[model samples]
Target chain A: MIIDQNKIDETIKIIKANGGHGIQKCVQCGACSAICPGVKAGFPLLCRALIKDLLNGLLEENIENSSSWGCQACNRCTEVCPQGVRPQEVVFAFRRYQANELAFSTSAVTSQMNLYETGHAVFTDPKEARRKVGLPEETPTSAFNEAAQQEIRTLMDNSPMGELGLF
Target chain B: MEQIGLYLGCNIPLKNPDIEQSFRKIFPALDVQPVDLEGAGCCPAWGTAPSFDLNTWCAISSRNITIAEEKNVDIMTGCNSCFGVLSEAKHFLETPATRTAVNNSLAKINREYKGTSDIYHVAHVLHKKIGLTKIRENLKYKLDGLKIAVQTGCHTLWPSDVYKVKEDNPYFPTMLKELCEVTGATVCHYSRLEGCCGMGGMRSTDAEKSLKLFKEKLLSIKEETNADMIVTTCSSCFMQFDMSQPILKGRGVIDFEPIPTFYYTQLLALAMGFDPQQVACISQIDRNPIIAEIQSDTRRIKEGM
Candidate 1:
């Protein structure tokens, strides 16, 4: 599944506009790669390499099966990034672009997509959910009751962020 | 006190009710109210859409926001995963570009998020509006003898701009420990206070890797702090600690209780003299030591008299 080089370009523009800097300032010091908690633990993380690939249009071939998905999004790279290019966000943005272009995204990504389709993420079968997750026979009324009485909810509704929807 | 609709996703209400009871007991004193927002389901977090289809996620998350708006109060969450998803959704609808796309998509459901209300975790409520002084004033039982390791769950700290606080370091356990200190507990300083639990998304995909990463941190706490309990502000982290610690022990990772993972609010309630059963729901755990410790404390206080 070759991602259009143009799609990668568009996501970079989106990420930069979203306040991510140093996307283009990469010196490829391997700082992001070396300091990455995932990379050090025998996980596949070409974080610095991936950013360079995207910038140089070298990601089209292996875009789908790339190891970028291994990123935990912990932003260790963002913290260590000498050039300020957030490899974490860049990789995510790239994945998002390529995922959109493909017919089938990764299983994890698709499962989450199914969540909105059914209002539940894990179980597609309703009866299975009840049997396995121990969902009650009722409509989970008590759970909502407890939620309604929590103090933080009231404070949240009343905050400025709550008002602006950035909460 | 004004009551806002509360959205207790999954873990807090069923798996961990101690925190729920604590919020019930304490918030009234803080002049804040909790409202019941019905028909609300999971915000889904990483479970929502890795595909990044903005419209579906917005509609589902906005549907949740709309429930709170309908109740005419803001939605509050105890789970960091819930807070992250709801907060991010709110951010999406507020931005002009994302808002337009989401609004155009959600037109099918007749639901639109006005970006009207805020979503908050309980820690923010205690530290901000409810102030430590007020909580300290109400404490009848001091946490003097208990050594607590405050675990600030990942979502509670990340994307720092959204969940702002007075911490010198976002990874620092200051806000949480300060709350514990107000109740007279000693907050042990530990390495990796800001480290990931590695359980959030990985639990569903790679349980072994997730448990392995989590076990390392759990063992570190026992070696570093020798603390009685591990306290946290997120439900996922709580579940990971409470369940993973014991399971990892069987796997030869550690040989301890994994320190009881109490919600910060529950610990506050315990310090305020709330009974363990009232403040801590027993059904949530497979261990008895947490309740046993509180009962023993009650006996000691009785004997002193």
Candidate 2:
């Protein structure tokens, strides 16, 4: 594979912009992978591997891999990294690239759609539960307030999520 | 006695209104006022906006914080995922570049990312703001003989840097255990105490894989602690254990009987003399056996005293 230095630089730039500070300082220490439940659960992608690929300008070749989504984003990787590489942030950075520049998972799209439509990512008719618990039949949430839902919709419409046709 | 704005996020209101009700009863009893975070939307969750872009994630999360800012109070959430997203959003907005981009998006809605309010998990508020002394004093009934396992959830412990209140040792956090102990329950030390319950976006992405993680944690809790009840600080973890365990068992993934689960606030509400029907109304798994055990133990303790 052709090693595109410009692609690697662009990827790093986006990662840095998205709170993946100290990512380049990653020392290929497998601590993140060792601690990651995703790796434990048999996912192929590991934080150390992803960082190596990103640094080597190989992210695009592996951009479509589902293993990127395996991250729980538990921040365990961030906690154990000696170099402060914050591998979870790098995972998120790659996810952002996949989601915006390429494609997003159906579940992600549905969740964004839920947020746009109802002002919540997971909306259920909560009135009965609230009333059962002696709370007002209508809890103070966007689900009960049309004006609030509109405000959320407007925000999503103007955000990058909307631009990506996520909603 | 400061009023703290309550951010319900999505799950607590929908899947576990009982936890919300528990907070309602317990917060006032502790002298900490719980204000309704009116018109606040989703934390937009990590699986959604943060997966797409940071600027969008921060903008949406900042909007929610701005609502709390307008109320002039710090925001507290019962869900760890909401805590994680909102706290990270606050941290993101602290940087000029990210804040400017987020503000640029917010400008469309006539809003700005003002770093005025801090986000807190409810457990932090109980430990820091409410104080263990107050909690102990208000306990009308002690969980004297109850052996409880605690799940602090992944979000509450990790990324401790952005969080305003953190466990003294984030790796082996004591805040949840300490809070559980104040209810007079013996907090058990489990091998997998810090493992993820796998109830986040991962569950939706791959249910089988998610259940594998939950099964491992649950089995470890059962084997290591063998506690009567499991208490958690996060609503998602509550669902994973209380809601998912039976299904996993039925699917033949595990053979152990499902353990009863409680959000720490619900346990507090019950220990503070509220009826179980009042605070813990909606549990997927049967809690009657555990509740009966607690009541019987309380009576025995009362007789001894």
> lDDT at A108 for candidate 2?
66
Q: Model 1 compared with the native: what TM-score?
A: 0.77
Worst 10 residues of 1 chain B by lDDT: B296-305
lDDT of 2 by residue, B180-206 (tens): 998778988978877888887677767
Clashing pairs in 1: A22-A85, A148-B35, A148-B36, A153-B76, A157-B74, A162-B117, A162-B118, A167-B87
DockQ class, candidate 2: medium
Interface RMSD of 2: 1.4
The docking category that best describes candidate 1 is incorrect
For residues B1-305, could you state the per-residue lDDT of candidate 1 as single tens digits? 87766787655554454566677777886778877666566675553343344444555677678777866787778888878677766765767877776565445446566777788778878887689888877765555677888787766665554553435666565778787777666788878677667666556545666766776677678788988777888877887887777787677667665577788877776666666666665433453575466445542333232
TM-score of chain B of 1: 0.89
**Fnat per model, in the order shown:** 0.09, 0.73
